[model samples]
Target: MSFIRQNSKLVDEFWEKGIVESCPIYDMHGHMGEHYAIYFAAPNADEMVTLMRRANVAKLCFSHHFSLWATPHVGQAPALEAARKYPDILRFYCSINPHYPDQIKQDLAKVGEWIPYCVGLKFLPDYHKIPVSDPAYKPALDFAEALHLPILIHTWNGSPYDGPAVLRDVVPHYPHVTFMCAHCFNNNWTAAGELAKDYPNVYIELTSVPGTRGAIEKMVSICGSEKILYGTDMPWFDEHQGIGGVLAADISDDDIHNILHRNAEKILAPFL
Candidate 1:
């Protein structure tokens, strides 16, 4: 770690000041309310904001857990309310549960009303038990493509629902939408890297990525820093730990900056 500090000024600054003012963090993947299966010490908007302030997080674009797991009618309110309450530091992704096509249609129709606060759409195909290429997600996909929205999809190594093969079929179709491969397709780095490299609009999101040693460095080597986006499943994961992992990686300060905020800022510019 000392070698990392010696080579990277950002790392040294973070070590000395707890947070680097020069490199503000923009968390692209996060969640709001508590999950039914897990316990969170700071799951609410207020608690999350407090944590963000301490970590020098510039913004956190999140989709509430309720919005992802529960029915749209019951889940969307919390995300919308949180974003409305903290417009400056917070933004939300409209979660689409493909399980209910009617709900998906209804939610996609109202997406415009949640604008500025709503940055894009989120899909948990793995949980929804539907492939990303399924017709059930077409309405939301069309909306995102039309608006050039960023869609964060929960991808895993070999998940039939949202795996690399399924994503390949879907990514090229919606060229306008920014596809954020959350968790970097989990353990399948090759597929994740290939997706980022093959598709200009596709990016590798570092949510659970940092936990695997050399993952960040490897991703940078594979797709370059510009194709990598910083993300932490906040409340579900520690913000400081996520940021620190990037700062401590065997990569340059410029790469760290890109992952932490630069790339995210570029992608979010149109919406903001």
Candidate 2:
């Protein structure tokens, strides 16, 4: 066998299989339904949905800066609108910037009204500037628990200023909150896998880690595919590239099912 076949065997297989390559994979973590700054630009919402539809993305988790980290409060209402317009393609998640004046509660209320439209909640602690475990926003936590909505959050790794808050503290406090830690706690992939091993509610996304060596091996070992989710982090990253990296991991067919799609379906199926 050639080196390319040996290393990217799974990648090739998945590509050949196309959308049917894995279980009903829903992108559990992604952000697009926002006004883009020069620094960050992605295909507009329609284009995004189109891409997702082509990729057979059954569900999408989106956050809006208006209600999230933006000033003057932009409600994720537009995100919900997109979800409504493309019910099969989107699952809106209300966002909270605890730093914003009354945003914590306000976003929660918007989430409540988003009923019949959206599915869960998203937090950008690195960009929003909120302590993950802060009791100040217990309302949001409580709502997630009550609504049985999973909370997906961004975490830091090598990037010095990605997500300022540590997810470790928050996971312990909200045991019932199904938390999807983005970046797989880059600096803490092992820890993330341990959390998944330890807690049923905790899950991890393979957004960039597979691009590295150690993280991929550690993830396969610790999380064992079932608790892992596949997402590219999109525009900032590449879906096919991320998928290629994951397929390159030393894992099995069953493992591929969980990482690429099964786990995501399990997590978001309730809302979908």
- For every model shown, what is its TM-score relative to the native structure? 0.97, 0.85
> Per-model C-alpha lDDT, please?
0.89, 0.67
Q: Check candidate 1 and list the clashing pairs.
A: none
Model 1 RMSD vs true structure: 1.3
Off by over 4 Å in 2: 1-10, 33-41, 157-166
What TM-score does candidate 2 reach?
0.85
TM-score of 1: 0.97
Q: What is the C-alpha lDDT profile of model 2 across 1-272, one tens digit per residue?
A: 53322654555655765455445456666666444563444544687776666566666666654556563445666667677887776777777666654766666776766765677777776675556666655678788888778887776764332332355555677766888878887767777788778778888877767668667668779867788887765545555566667666677767877787788877776665
CA RMSD, predictions in order = 1.3, 3.2
What's the count of clashing pairs in each model shown?
0, 4
Q: Which pairs of residues collide in candidate 2?
A: 66-74, 67-74, 126-163, 126-164
Q: Encode model 1's per-residue lDDT on 33-87: one tens digit a residue.
A: 8888889999999999999998899889999988888865575789989999988
